[model samples]
Target: MPELPDVEQFRTFFHAHATGRTVRSVEADPTIVRNTDPAALDRALRGRRFEDPDRHGKWLIGWTDGPALLLHFGMTGDLVWSGEDPHRHRHDRLILAFEDGNELRYRNMRKLGGVWLAHDREEVAQVIGALGPDALSIGRSEFGERLARRRGGVKAALMDQTFVAGVGNILADEILWQARLHPRRRIETLDEAERATLYTVVRRVLREAVRSYDYVGRKRSWLTHVRGIPGGTCPRCGTSLQRATAAGRTTYFCPRCQAADPAVGSGP
Candidate 1:
């Protein structure tokens, strides 16, 4: 699924190309639009100019002169910009044609996540009300407090959107690995110091991801460089990375680096 950083990039993309541009036409797939149908979306968005967009967690909110557009790029979804004679892929769920003849396409293959049209601010709140504080902006104290409330594995707690929005499987593993904490480590078992360390690590990792457009494979030191490859070794140590089901998602970590006991830890 698209996490916070990815969605942030999408927000930047949308703001650069679509903002302030009038929508010349609207083409939407009904099945890929939530909260409203295709005809309604067209009626609401046509002739409106897109304003600056905001991102909360993995959701993108696009404010127009009229209605609001909400987008969630599930597991395999992305926003694409095309020029003249664009080859419209079959998976292009939503297409917004601009007055300048440019196009912004919301493409998704699996169709797990979709677009939503909100007529008012109340409707927008209703859609995103369930999400917790965005991971990027949550305070350290609040972050620790929320994690302390989770009685499950630390990895699972991080992956729970209700606990702290925008973290998914890949980010959870990366954060935990960097913090030198095991994926199976119980949240309740972490001391204040450990929790503080975790808070710092989360902020650092997330910010690094947001700053770098090509973060995942750009650095050899990042675990994401070899997350799921065959015989992938730890970036810190030479130990072969291990994989298991944590938080119901495939997790990868270095056994030697991320010890269950903090006392035996490699410094984060």
Candidate 2:
């Protein structure tokens, strides 16, 4: 799953390559773009100029003349840039040919990715209404206040989009491991120091992720390095990493570093 880091990387790429360009053409193959009708998408975007691109959580928003295009990269979706022919990838569901002869394509191997045309920019607010403050943008005080109110496990609270936007399975696990907090620890149980640590870890992890290219899992030093490596050792503690499902997604944690808290073991 593309987390906050990956989404931010894509946003930067889009802003550099596609923003402020006039759309010469729009193409969509129904088999690939699952959520959007081909004809309607084409009618809404063709010949319009791309205003700017923005991101919230994992959602990518590209503004046009009237409607805004929303892209949700379910699991395996990505954007590619090429000055040559654009139809090189069979998975390319949405293609925008610019007047400058450059092309930007959205490719998704899994059909789970969605493309929605929002008639108004405010529609984006409705689509991601559950999202809390952006992980990168939230202040330490605000994060602490939000964390103090939650009763769920620490991992669940971080993973909840409503609690903090842009934190996915990988980030949640990495942040918890870095903060030395067990995944199942109750949010209210965290002291002021622990809450501050959590906020710092979240910002640090996201900063490192954004610096990496495309937020792809290509770097060995990244948190993605420990995410699903079966029997992988902890990067900091040198102990074996453990895996389990928390909040319905696969989670990784350093058992030695973040021991299970008895007090919060039964939390939501």
Candidate 3:
């Protein structure tokens, strides 16, 4: 799934290419846009002009004259921009041709991504109502408060969109590992110092992610170096990195660094 940083990059791209451009045409292949009815989409967007694009959590909103078009890129979905041919890929769920000859395409391999037109602000609010404060926008005090209130594992809490929007499995593991907080530690067990450390770590990780374009720690960097290596030894401690399941998602953490509260450790 495209997380906050990836979506942010997409927003930048959309803002530059599609905003203020008149829609020349709207094309959709029913097989690719499984979540929306094609006729309704064409009727709503074909002749309208695309305004600014906005993002909340993992959802991308493209504003038109009336309603906003919402995009959720489910695992393998992405947007492409080209100046040449407008139509090429079978996976292109939605295509918008511009008057300037440039085109923006929404493509998805798995077809799990979705699109919806929100006729009013209330509809947009309802779609993202469950999301907590955006991880990047929330303050330290508010983040601490939310962290202190949850009793689940810190990793699971971070992964929960209702707890902190925009954090996914990879980010949850990276942030917890950087803070040296075990993934299985109960949230309420965190002291003031731990909470502060987690908050700082989250900010640092998110900033690094934004700067690097979602490729954080994917290279030789400390966090990225460890995360991409399966069955690899911990970078800080030599103990073998552990893999387990939490909240129905695969999680990775260093046992020596983020080992569970010695008093409450257990296998998944």
lDDT of 3 by residue, 1-268 (tens): 4888888888898898889998777777676544357777777787788888998878888998877778888878788888644456877788877777778988888878667768778888886678898887889989977876788777889989899888888888888888888887788788778889999999988878878854755545455566647677777766788888876788777887786774554233
For model 1, how many clashes? 0
Residue pairs that clash (backbone atoms under 3 angstroms), model 3: 217-224
TM-score of 1: 0.95
> What tens-digit string does per-residue lDDT give for candidate 2 at 1-268?
5788788878887888888888877888777554468888787787788877889888899887778888888788888998544455988888888888889988888878667778785776776567898888899889877877789788888878888888878778778877888887777777777888888999998887788664535756545675677778877756778887777778788777787763443222
Model 3: ten consecutive residues of lowest lDDT: 259-268
- What lDDT would each prediction earn against the true structure? 0.90, 0.79, 0.79
Per-residue error (Å), model 2, residue 55: 1.1
Comparing 1 and 2 by lDDT, which wins? 1
How displaced is residue 13 in candidate 3, in Å? 0.9
User: Of the candidates numbered 1 and 3, which has the greater lDDT value?
Assistant: 1
TM-score for candidate 2, please give it: 0.89
User: Candidate 1 on 36-114: residue-level lDDT in tens?
Assistant: 8888898889999999999999999999989899999999889989963378999999999998999999999999989
Note the residue pairs that clash in candidate 2.
none
Of models 2 and 3, which has the larger TM-score? Answer: 3
